[model samples]
Structure formats: structure tokens, C-alpha cells
Target: MSGGLARCSGSPDRDPGLQPERTRLAWRRTTLAVTVASVLAVRTALHGRAGSGELPAVACAILAWLGFVVVAHQRIRALSTPRPPLLTHRAALLTAICAALVAACGAALVG
Candidate 1:
């Protein structure tokens, strides 16, 4: 156990906090959201409405997914670097920004 991986020395039947799982789920959720937006954008574009609201929605979704990817990579790096808190904070901030971007896109679509 001298390398750098986080230890799971207690019991194998316990929850163990699930930090890695949460990070993976975050990535999955973001990716799904982006995919949905991309599909919608393509559909709208095919209908001759590319720059109305679908573009913004697609851009925001892609940006959010990219943020999630960054968070996932950071979490993996933290597994061997002892930098959990920093990665967690960055991920949270990125999520918040993505949420705001989504909201803004919604508002623009409304008006």
C-alpha cells in the first residue's frame, strides 16, 4: 500500500463514500443531457430553425458535458494525487456554471 491509491482497509461490504461512483454518474448525466440537446438541435435545424433556440441549447449542453469531462478527469487524477477537496470544489463550481448557462438559454428561448 505504498503506492498512492486510496485505501479501503475496513470492510468490503460497506458504502465507502462512493466518490468515484458519484464522479462517474456526474459524467454520465452531463453526457446524456448533451446528447439530448444535440438531437433536438439537429431536429430543429432540419426543420429550418437552426439559430433560433436550439443552437444555444446545444452549445450549453456541450459546454456542460465538457465541464463534466474535466471533473471526471480531475477526480481520476486526484485518486493518486491527494487532491480531493480541490477537485470536488472545481466540479461543483463547474456544475453551477453549467446550470446557469442552461437557465440563460431557456430564458433566451422564452423571449
Candidate 2:
């Protein structure tokens, strides 16, 4: 009766530990925290009277959030599966870049 690989059979990975759910929740929390910081950056840029410099900083902050959202959304979706695939190098790189952008914008705004 056995045929093909277990993955190909579309069997849901039995995970009694609920680790996947925990990971998904952690991702959601991280997204929320980053979003809050981004909003604060925008607020500072708009209200600080930084003039033209504000535009680029605000733009970068928003762009970073968007990039992070794309990656986080993908991860979140993957976590929904019973047996999610391993995170790829591309995804990790993009995530780091996005986070760096957000942090840079935050620092620039604060200073």
C-alpha cells in the first residue's frame, strides 16, 4: 500500500507539541511591534518640522514596513501548514534587510 514519499502523500505532520502555532504567534507579535515603531517614526517625521528631510525618512519607514510585511505574511502563511518548509536564504536576507531599514529610519528620525 505504501507509495511515493510521505511529503508527496500530503499527510499532515502530527505535531502534538504545538510548536508551529507558537512560532506563528511570535511572528505576529514581532510584526505588531515593528508596526508600532514605524508609526512612531512617521509621527516624529510629520510633527518634528524636519522639512524636506522628513519625506525620505518617512518614505523609508513605510517601505521597510511593507517589505517586512511581505516576508512576515509569507512566513505566517507557511506556519499555517501542518509541515511548513524551511526558511530559505532569500527570505532570511530580505527579512534582515527590511529590519535594518526600519531601524535605520528609526534612528535617523530620533536623531
Candidate 3:
């Protein structure tokens, strides 16, 4: 008996394992970190004295966070299925590129 548990949409089998849950949580956590970084970048921009590249760095930070959110949301949705597909190279590359952009903004703010 499923004990009143509702089957997840598009998941044919009832998975007893927590692997999918764990993966979803990990994605959420990473997204949260990126969100925090983006907020910090904005705060720094507002408080710090104006610099030549500061506005661009803050804009990039916001755009990168948006990109990561989109990618993470898709990955999280895919993981909901019982047999989630493997991460595509395109998705992986996009995530990495977004992360690098955020990091570059941080470094630029510091310098």
C-alpha cells in the first residue's frame, strides 16, 4: 500500500529511495547561494563609491543569477521523474558559465 501517498506526476514507479529528493535539495541550496551572492553584489554596488565598471559588474551579477535560476529550475523538474535523464553538456556548460560570471562580478568588486 502507498499509505495515502500520491504518485509524483510522470513518475511511473513509486521510488522508495531518497536520491531524487536529495538531488532536488542540493539544487535548491545552490540556487539559494547564488541568490545571496547576487544580493550582496547589489548591496555593495549601492554602498560603495561609484566606479567605472561597478554598474556593469552588478548588472552581470543579476543576469547570471537569473540564468542559473532558469537552469536549476529545469534540472529540478527533470529530477521529479522516476528515471531522470542525464544532465546534458549544454546544461552543464550553461551552469558553469553563469557561475563564472557571478564570480567575476565578485572579483571585480573586490579589485
Candidate 4:
């Protein structure tokens, strides 16, 4: 019990604070939002008569969804350890970029 895993008392129960569970739930929510946006973008693109003009927006949405999936995977993996690592700045930046892209796509579809 001298290693990193020893941080816990082996009670077979999660911490009372439930930090890891909360973090994982938050990540799932984010992924769900991105997925919904991507689906909306694809639906809009399909309904429009712009042909290939809307493809870029759809592509951006797809990429954003994929990016979120990657982030979530990393987050879950990190949470599996006895001592969870802090969220990476790079992941935050990527999430922001993806959100912006999705917003822009929605705006473009509107106007």
C-alpha cells in the first residue's frame, strides 16, 4: 500500500465527495450536447438546397463531435486511476474551439 493506489483505504466504496463520478457525468453531458448540435447541423445541411456549400459546416460538426469523444475517453481513463489527474488545458482549448465551430455552423445555417 505504498504506491499511488494506496491513497484510498480500500473500503470498496467511492469517496463521499463523488468527484470522479461527477466529472464523468459532466463529460457525458458535454458529449451529448456536441452530438445533438452535430445532428442538427447535418439535418439542416440535408434540408437545404445549397448543395456542397453546407458541407463544410456539417464537416465541422462531425469533427467537433469526434473531438469531444476523444476528450471524454481521456477523461474517463484518467478517472480510473486512484489519483485522478486534473483536466488538461489543451482539452479545454479544444472544447472551446469545437463549441465555437458548432455555434458558427448554426449561425451560418440560420443566415
Candidate 5:
């Protein structure tokens, strides 16, 4: 039966159960995509062999997109769960790590 049909069944509404497995899967997908984007960002940023080059705005954009994905994944997870945010504090650290990696690449360009 469809989810709406199930809800209409005359049964007592227990609770809107969070689909943990699906949430986790979404996180996994987001992480995987971000990882790939990060690699591409690094490669693009390092493309010029020597001398100053234009800032790789593409990489910056990718990084920002990754951050959005992280936020989106977290939001979905929070909505699925009834308790306090399961990812509570990890989001900041994760974003920091990703940002640090991108920064390191940029620094290498300046070196």
C-alpha cells in the first residue's frame, strides 16, 4: 500500500518514524560526490605548471556545493529523526576538514 493509504488505515498514528537507513544512504551518496568533486577541484587548481594563474573559481564553487550537500544531508537526517540531531556536532568538523584540504591546495599554488 502507498504511504498515504497506510496513514489513512484507521489505525492509531504511532509516530512518524525516521528512516535511518535511507538517511544514512543519502549521506553516503553526498559524501561520495563531494569526495569526487574535491579531487577534481584539486586537479583544476593545480593545472598551471608555473607562475601565478587565475584563481580556480570552479574549485571554489565545487567546495561551496559540497558544503551545501553536507547541509542538505544533515537536514534530511534531522527531519527523519525525532530526537536531537544525530549528526549534532560532526557537521562542523567535516566541513572544516574539507575546507582545510581545499585551502592546502590553494597554498600549494602560492608556494
Candidate 6:
């Protein structure tokens, strides 16, 4: 047990660049944006003249919103650890899928 190992002393004393806090804030903002977009997509689906054509867009928006939520949770949990976690391939893939869904929803609204 004499090995040089730093015990968990709760929070760090010195500021670690506040990078984790910034990252948490960024995740929150992204979640908010996704929520707003999803709401808008639902509204468009309800009022659009294309009938069922906008339903897929709404579905995609909802899925994107859920994906964002999962990401936010993962991000928060990762930030809580002593060593910040790197962005995994799964996160990148989820983000890309969400972005594409949002873009599709926007295009559906326009066209």
C-alpha cells in the first residue's frame, strides 16, 4: 500500500481549467436545442398540409431528443470521474445520427 496513490479527497483544490464544467454546460445546451427542435417538429407534423408526410420527421425528432438525453447523462457521469472520459465511437455515432435526423426534419418542414 506504500505505492504512490492519491486517495479521493472529494473535489480537487486547484482549478483544473474548469473544462468539465464547460463540457457539462455544452451538453445541457445541446439537450435544450434538441428538445426545442423536437417540439417544433411535432408542431409542424400536427399542422403541416402534407398529412402523414411529416410524421416521419416528428418521429426522427423524438428519437433525436432521446439520443441527446442519453448523451447528456453519459457526459455528466463521465465528467464526475477523476479522469475525464474521451468521446467514444458510440457517442460520435449517436451524435451524427441525431444531427442527420434533425437535418432531415428541417428539410421535411421546408419541402
Pick the TM-score winner: 3
> In model 3, where do residues sit more than 4 Å from their true spots?
1-5, 9-12
* Each prediction's number of clashing residue pairs: 0, 0, 0, 0, 0, 0
Top candidate by lDDT: 3
TM-score-based ranking? 3, 2, 4, 6, 1, 5
For candidate 1, give the lDDT of residue 10: 38
- Model 2 lDDT vs. the true structure? 0.78
What's each prediction's TM-score?
A: 0.46, 0.82, 0.85, 0.80, 0.40, 0.77
Relative to the unseen true structure, what is the C-alpha lDDT of residue 21 in candidate 1, on a scale of 0 to 100?
47
Give a tens-digit lDDT track for model 6, residues 51-92. Answer: 556767777788887887887788766765455779789887
| Deviation in Å, model 2, residue 78 alpha carbon | 1.2
Please, what are the lDDT tens digits per residue for candidate 5 over residues 1-111? 134334333345424453543555566676676667666666666675655543655456466657757675666545443233556566767665666656565565546
Q: Higher TM-score: candidate 2 or 6?
A: 2
Pairs clashing in candidate 5? none
Residues 31-91 of candidate 4 have per-residue lDDT tens digits of 8888898898888888877765687778878887788789777887677555578888998
Worst 10 residues of 4 by lDDT: 1-10
lDDT of each: 0.54, 0.78, 0.82, 0.75, 0.56, 0.71
Candidate 2, which ten residues in sequence have the lowest lDDT sum? 1-10
Deviating ranges (above 4 Å) for candidate 6: 1-9
Clashing pairs in 1: none
Model 2 alpha-carbon miss at residue 54, Å:
0.9
